[model samples]
Target: MHSLRPCLLFLLLALMISAVPVSAEPPTVMVADYTISPAVLQPGDVGTITAIIRNTATTATVSEKTGLPGSGAFESSKSTDIGVNIESVQLDSKDVEVISGNYKRVGSIGPGQSIPITFLIRAPAKDGIYFPEIWIDVTGGQSVRQPVPVNVNTQIALLKKPALTAIKTVPEAIGPGDEVNARVVLRNDGQSRADQVTVIVNCSSPSITQKTPSTFHAGSLLRGENTSIDMVFLTDKNAPIGINRVCLTISYVNPDGTITSQDEVIGIHVRGRAKIGIASLSTDPVRIRKGDPVSLVIRLENTGTDNANSVKATIDLPFAGNKAAYVGKIEPDNDAPAVFSLQAGSPGTYTYTLTVQYEDDYGVQTREERLQMTVLDGDATGVVIAGLLVFLLCAGAAYWFLTRKKGPGNA
Candidate 1:
C-alpha cells in the first residue's frame, strides 16, 4: 500500500504540471522618432506633435517539448508572426495644454513595422523651455515612453548646423576626343552660413583630363543661397567606353571655424564613335584602256576609337562587271580592302560616285564621294594592223610599175 501511494502521488504531480500553459517571450516595442510642427512655438500658439513607434524584432519563436520517459524526447521550434496591439497612446502635457488628439484602441504593428500617432496641443503662456513626454501601452509587449523638447519663444537654437548640397549638370553622352562642358551648383540648405567654400574635381582615369582649372572658390554662401561653377574637361582619343566616374570634394568653414568636407560623384557616359573613310584607291592595270579587263580596289580605313562592322562599298560607274564589294570589319587604326573586277567601257573620263556603308554603335551609316577615272582609246593592236595592210598594198603597186618598165627596155 505504501509503494502504491508514492506512485499515485507522482502521477498526480505530472498531471498538474502538464495542465499549466507555457508562456512565450514578449515582443519588444520602441519609439522610433517624434516631430513637432512649428518647431518654435509662440506663447499661446497651437501646434501638432507626432510620435512614431516601431517593433524591432526580426522573428517570433515558440518552443515545445514532448515524448515520455525513455522515448527519445526532443524539442521542436516554430516561427510565428507576433504583432503588438496598441491599446492607448497619451501625451503627458504638464506645461502645454492638450487639445484633442488622444488615441485609443489603435490597431496592431507587425515586426519591423512602425506607426505614427499625432496629437494637437497648445503652448503655455510663459516663454521658456519645456520637456513633454508621451506614454504608449501595447498588449503582450513592452510599453514605450519617450520625451520631446518644446520651446516657447526662446533665444536658444535647437540645432545650429550647416548642410551643403551639390547639384550638377553634365552632358548626357560624350564621345572620344570631345570637349565637355559641365556645371555644379552648390546650395546651403541649413540655418547657418558657410565660409571659404571650395570644390575640387578629380578623375583617376588618365584618358580624362581637365581643360580648365580643377578647383573653384565660392568664398561664402548664406542660408538658402546657391552658387554655380563652370568646368571643362577633355577626353583622349582612346578614352574607354561606358560610365566614367569623377569625384568632387567640397570643403567649407562653419560659423565656429570648423572645417567640414564631403564627396559627391558624377557619372559621365562615354560612347565611342568609329570614323570610316577611304584611305586610297588603286587599279590592277596602271593605265586602263577601252575593252580591257580591270580590277579596282578601295582601301577603307577606320581612324576612330571603335570597330566598324559589315563594311561594303559600291561604285556607280558604266562598267560591265561586279559593282559592289564587301570589306568585312575594319578596326580602329586599321584598314581593309574592297575589290571589284570590272570591264572598261568607252574611252573617256568617267565621273562616278563611290558609296561606302558600315555600322558602329550608332547603327548603319554611309559615306559617299564623287570620283573620276579616265580610259585611253581602244587597244593599239587595231591601229598597227591597219598600217601594215597599207604598206603591203603600196609595195605591190611599185613592184608592178617597175616590172612593166623593165620589159619595154629589154624589147
Candidate 2:
C-alpha cells in the first residue's frame, strides 16, 4: 500500500504538469534581398521593385506539459514543428506611388523558404529622396514592415530631354496614281515632356506630293506618350517604282525653354500595277503549211513597274497538240517567250486570237489580240510546180519545132 501511494503521487504530479498550457515559437519572416529596376529613376518614371522574403524559422516547436505513465512519459513541455502562412504583402512610399501589384498573397512558406514579391511603382513628380516601406502580413495577425531607400532624380539634374521618334507609317505600301491617307505616329521616348510639338513631312522625290497639310501641331506630349498625325499624299502616275524616302522634321520646346529639332527619314515602298502586253508574235517557218508541224512563238513584255506572275499564253487557232505555253514570271521592262508546237489544219488565211493570262497585285487579267495567219495547202505547192514544168516543156518543144523547120527549108 505504501508503494501504491508513491505511484499515485507521481501520477498526480504528472496530471498537474499536463494541465499546464504549452507555448510555441511563432514564425519570423524577414526580407532576404531587394532589387529595383532602373536603379536611378527620374521624376514621373515608372519602375519595378522586387522584394525577396524568407521565413528563417527552420522548425517551430510547441511546448506541452505531458508525459505517458510507466513508459517514462511525464507531464512536460512538448515541441511541435510548424510552417508559416503568409496572408498578404504591400508596399508604401511617399515619393513613389504604387501603380500595380501592391498586395500579393503567398499561401504557405516552409522553414527557410523564400518568396519574391514585385510591385510596379512610379516616381513622384517632384524629385527627392524617399523611403518605401514593405509590409508583410502573416496568418497570426502579425505584420512585418521594412523601409527601402530610393532616390528620385530631377529632370533638370538628369538632363533627360524630350525625344521624338517616328514610330510607324500607315499604308506602308503605295502605288502610282494612288491617293493615300497616311498616318504617322510620333512618340516621346525621353523622360521630360514636350511642349508645342510640331512634325513636318517633306517629299524628296518630285513624283510624290503632299496633298494635306505638311506640318502638324501637337499641343503637348508627356513622356512615354504617343500621338498620331493623319496626312494625305498623292503618287504621280509616272512615279518610278522603288523605295521612296520621305523626311520628317520634328521640333519641340524643351523644359529649359529651348527649341530642339530632329530630322528623320522614312522609306516607303512604291509599287506599280503590273501591265503586260504581247511584244511580238512570229512562227518558226514564217508561213504555215497544212498538215505540218507549226511552232508559234509569242513574246510577252511587262510594261509596268511590277512583275507579272503566272503568265500563260494560248493560241486560239484550230490546231492539234498543246496550244498553251507557261511563261512564269516576267519582271518590269522584261520579256518572256511562250512557245507552242501545233499542226496546221487547212490552207488559206485564218484569223485567230492570242490570249494572254497573268496575275498581278489586284487579280488575274486576260488580254486577247487578233492575229492573221496564212496557212498554205500541203498539195498546192507540188501542183503549182508540176504545172509550171509542163508549161516550160511545151514552150521549149514549140520553139524547137519552129526553129528546126525553118532551118531545114533554108538547107
Candidate of highest lDDT: 1
Q: Judged by TM-score, which candidate is best?
A: 1
Residue-by-residue lDDT tens digits, candidate 2, 17-136: 554445556787888999988787888899988999898777655555445544545545555566788888899876689998766567888888898999999988877777899999
lDDT of 1 by residue, 216-277 (tens): 89999999999999888888877888877778899999998899999998777788778888
Per-residue error for 258 in candidate 2, Å, reads 6.8
Model 2 misplaced regions, further than 4 Å: 1-173, 177-194, 202-247, 254-267, 381-411
Clashing pairs in 2: 62-78, 62-80, 63-78, 64-77, 64-78, 65-76, 66-76, 67-73, 67-74, 68-73
The per-residue C-alpha lDDT of model 1 at residue 129 equals 84
Question: How displaced is residue 250 in candidate 1, in Å?
Answer: 1.2
Error of 2 at 179 (Å): 6.5
Task: Estimate the Cα RMSD of every predicted model relative to the unseen true structure.
Answer: 18.1, 16.9
What is the Cα-based lDDT of residue 300 in candidate 2? Answer: 93
How many clashing residue pairs appear in each of the predictions shown? 0, 10
How does each model score on lDDT? 0.85, 0.82
